[model samples]
Target chain A: MKKLQIIALIFSILFAIIIVQSCKSTSNITESKFGAQLWGENCIRCHNTPSPETFSDTEWDVAVMHMRVRANLTESEAVKIADFLKTAN
Target chain B: MAFGQLYKITKEISNQVNIHKMKNLIILILSFFLILLMNQNVKAQDIQSTDEIQKLKQEIELLSKQNNSYKPGKSQFLLRGYAHSGLQTNNNGFSFVGGSFNPLLIYKQSDRLLFETELEMELVGSAVELGIEYANISYLLSKNITIRAGKMLVPFGIFVPNLHPAWINKFPTAPLGAGHEGILPTNDIGVEIRGGSYLGNLKVNYSFFAVNGGQLNDGMEEPEEAGIIHHGIFPDNNNGKTIGSRIGIFPFSNSSMELGFSAMYGKTGARESDVEDIKALHYAFDISYVKTLSSMSSVLDLKAQYTGVNVSDANYPEHDDPDELYTFDNKSKTWFAQLSLRPALVENPIVRNLEFAIRYSDLLTPEGAEWHVNQSQTDVGINYWFDWRTVVKFSYRIRSGFEGGHSEEPSHGGVEEDGGNSFFIHWAIGF
Candidate 1:
């Protein structure tokens, strides 16, 4: 009986750990591996999390122009950022 | 003992996972609440820009008007008056304490019609003037047009008929004697048509009338010809009554441009002036523009005009001589360019609608034109809009050169010199 109980406890503990792990990543919908990696390196430093509604469509249009001048963000990187922000919300 | 230990281990692990989930849950809820607060702020700002508050204010005004109406079986009457007094000085040393009162009386007859009349009094010359500033039965032709006739203020150029000095401009005075010259005619006996279309941005106006051309009582003064007394109001002048017409267009809201031309000729002349029946032609062009500069946080408005008057030689009906000894030709022109700048466009509790402006004008007259003079007046002033329809103005003005020499008025009792210092205040209202 003692041995059986130990085995059951071990299985339950492992199950709980797996559930927490699944939930941790459940809401992080940055699905594209390349997009997520790029965001990790470029965006996460400035912002804790990316959200779309931070800037209006027109505001984003102006911001992109400013970023190009100041940050020298490449066209592809800008496109990636725009897509992420547009969908983040 | 081993089974009990295993149970304890399982329970501890479950508690740990639950606490972790609670922490994450709290973070998510807090973040959402923060976002919601931010969104509310953004929405409030959007509402302000859309002028929703103005709509509410208009509704309040309408309600107040209804509440103030007379009870059934009685006539409703309203009296509103405005007054102002100010001490002002200019860099050129012209200064004074001057003011004006423009009070209006209104009678309401249901929603279809209203009667209105205004009287004006000025401190300069301590002038007291009374007239039916606007007295016409306005027949609502349609939502787009109103036809009115009677002794009506002539609907001419944007400013000629609407020059209250107090309401439309910043300067306590007006464009180069525009206020005092009494050069421009005011009210006339005529029919006027006025209305709006194009989404309330464009206004169309027209008028036709016959009037006692030089009725000083009507706030209009006609120039006197040499040897001809009261040339403008004499019975002979009206026996050959003069006719005039005007058309005005406001292509956009807050901007109006008008071009007007009037010609009157008849056997009208002062007695014995036989003054051959005289024909006179007058043409005036006025253009005004207003712009809202969001980038500069200011508003700029410009107004300009050019006018010319030609009088033909008259034949003496009483004189048998082939040539009359007294014959003169007269022509006059005036031009003005003005700029107004109002910073801090938004109104606050302390600072209201305040504008600073400058104007340069040159008025030209025939070297020997009857009752005319050539002079240039430059003015700088500030307009403080106390309310929607009330404003206080302070201006400093300088005038120079009676172009041809001394002004014709100098030959009379009028003052003629390089210039003189003048200061004044005015109060105005419109419904």
Candidate 2:
């Protein structure tokens, strides 16, 4: 069906972008503390930034994981954000 | 006499020698005793010094323990909220509304326990109303599982829990059937277990809950006036319980694509009642995809959901009123799709963040229902983000096919049967 084709096309493009981005040297990207920066940048886009101490380290792990999928963050970016949140409290 | 004098002289000389020797021996013994006393004093001083050092060491250990006991990130409480104000214009006229001020309270008890509550106050014309949206307590059982209890937002779909925030909603209003007055149950008193895990390159999340079943109103005068099946707000007269679950999958590690499904089932009748117990079943499917174009500094978000509800044996008694003869349908369905594009991915000094979005929704009720049960709406909006948690939105909505003709004023905002169009400009902020 045409709908299937459109969906496939979208995924293909997304996968292509991921492949390209992954090929680049990420040494410079990981050097900066992406955790705190990404947390402020992405988490607040939808709702207020909850105080870091609002959830414990274990709770933050789950919360950040949920948001990562809900908000569309890369795995590395999600992990970094999760790390900062767990320690920030 | 000469011999006795010589003997006495010799004896006297011997006595003098003996006396001198005895005196020398006594002095030597005294000197030895003085040395022993000196040694005893030095040993006592040494013992005292050792005891003082031991006391100082114990004090240092106590201070160290106190310093370690002061945890930097312990339990805490916080208050945060959001407010919305806007103007809406329809066929009737323009009205100014001071929409709602919702305050949320969050308490973190420990690494394992948390509590959250939200109170919503809204102004309708000159009247004010207050309600509790959600109040729940959660305890983490492990790294991947949590147990939650209390009044919570129903986990039937993604819209209520994820996108209902005023600042986050793509449009000014919710899609048909998903709003406060929607047919779908938006909140429930219940307990749930939720968690997430990763499988290879994919991620998985799930929630399972049990709650009081919906209330059934069976004493209505007419079939069309059926009152049963109020979404689980109050204590259930029936002995039935509702069970629900939702599962989601993220297939790719690099891509933000989520696919989810949810289902709930329960009975809505009292035990051994005149009316046959109604069997209620509901299910929903939802998906979301987000893509960021680094070259263009743009982001695209797509989200959609489809929900359906079915009630079995909902036939009602016929009444003398002619208009009430129609039987309510056993099934209803609703769905919405939304797309949003944010052009300013990078923070621009002046332009900041700008986003455009469009959404379409449809709600279908059981055929032959007395009221207007079929509804559809389209919304197009533009959002200007002053900051991450604050936004100004301009939206135009075209709504049709609403039920009307009730004498009583509507509890929540409901349009007339002949639906009208409206333009709304609302400012939303979270703090």
Candidate 3:
């Protein structure tokens, strides 16, 4: 009984935060060749940054999507990172 | 008259033989001269055919491009993963260990759909072992949501999916309680809804899933492996599905820090059995902070997580006597905290590549269970970076518990029973 209550409470709080915060925030989408910045910020969080030349454009497509899921990146961020790798390469 | 006839026949025979020899010698000489003339003729023709050869090369290049164009463009395939080879000395003896090749395959069917698979191959003793860590397909539903199904890593904590890779982990070995017998679940079979968005200044992401929860080991087949839950196994033991989620909150604009919370609720005991209604609640909290201190010319990484499982009261068979049923407060708890420091901006190349890390972890299982124990471990480690995705790690560990690193003996135990006071040297590479 206590366990259920605790889980319910946690979920409720999480939902409340999502509702309140989402309303206060502006969309976080900007397209300014920001792939370089996205690549640096997310890659460094867990491991070192990989070079743009490390993968081909097609490989980067798959690689960035894998990272998108593993690191919880938005689809927009994933696409921008992919575009940067393609352009840089 | 006979003698005269014989002499005449002999002369005729000799003349014929001489004629035959002359014809043979003439043919041999003519054949040799013919070969020599052909060789020179071929050489002269080659020198005159350079333009033809160039035209042929151009044709070949065109054909190559045509072949490349015929390849399918809608689908893409990628092979990437990590591998490690190293040596170690546990309390039992000095030996070579830690050899594995983990490969991940991702095949994109369209812009929003992909199939991913990860295979783990390890060198164990004299044989090679193979396993499928996860095989799943995901579809991007929208900006804030994606759907995935099949076997995948449980979102119980950050370590399993994100930080357990050899090249990414600062230490050579895993934290004490993160292993096979640990409180955290590694993988599960389920459907998941995963995504996140920027909320104000905060970046929040979550993975919510429903899985056939892990099974409660009954100590039937292996006593040492009993009393605990076995994760990612096949064939559901019960109809109840476990519902779980992991939510990560990144408070900083630069995403330097992440705080995570995870919760799982489901029935684990076998259905149509004595303890079908008994359920388990698992929860975890994790935090990671990383920063580059310009003044100190160094980088610091700090990580910590706490995880526990609460199983409702149930009667389980005792390890010693199968007929004897025993019950206790069924719960398992584990926690680990680690810090890593590296002079990433130092002028000296050698100094800049060196990293130092220390960690403390504790594991506490149900007291009366076969795998029960109150244990603690401390590890000090150093690593030399070869590049962004390669490193050589050296670490030493100290163990203290009622039986030290041994989690067995009472029966149905987990982890290496003899791995106490260990030393490790590992080389990890990611590609």
All candidates: CA RMSD in angstroms? 28.4, 11.9, 16.5
What is the C-alpha local distance difference test score of each model?
A: 0.47, 0.68, 0.80
Q: Compute DockQ for each candidate against the true complex.
A: 0.01, 0.07, 0.33
Candidate 1 vs candidate 3, DockQ winner: 3
Candidate 1 overall lDDT versus native: 0.47
Among residues 3 or more apart in sequence or in different chains, the pairs in candidate 3 whose N, CA or C atoms overlap within 3 Å are B223-B412, B224-B411, B224-B412, B224-B413, B225-B412, B226-B412
Tens-place lDDT per residue, model 3, B289-401, is 88888998998888999999888887777668878888888888888899999999999999999999999988888887767778888889999998889999898888788
User: Which candidate would rank higher by TM-score, 1 or 2?
Assistant: 2
Higher-ranked by TM-score: 1 or 3: 3
Question: In candidate 1, how many Å is residue B249 off?
Answer: 3.2
Best by lDDT: 3
- In terms of TM-score, how similar is model 2 to the real structure? 0.71
Looking at model 2, residue B190 earns an lDDT score of: 89
Higher-ranked by TM-score: 2 or 3: 3
- lDDT, candidate 3, A1-89, per-residue tens: 87578776887687566645434423454333288887877788889889889998778888888788778787777888889889998
lDDT of 1 by residue, B21-94 (tens): 99999999999999999899999898886787788889999998887773243334566545555554444553
For model 3 chain B, give the 10-residue run with minimal summed lDDT.
B408-417
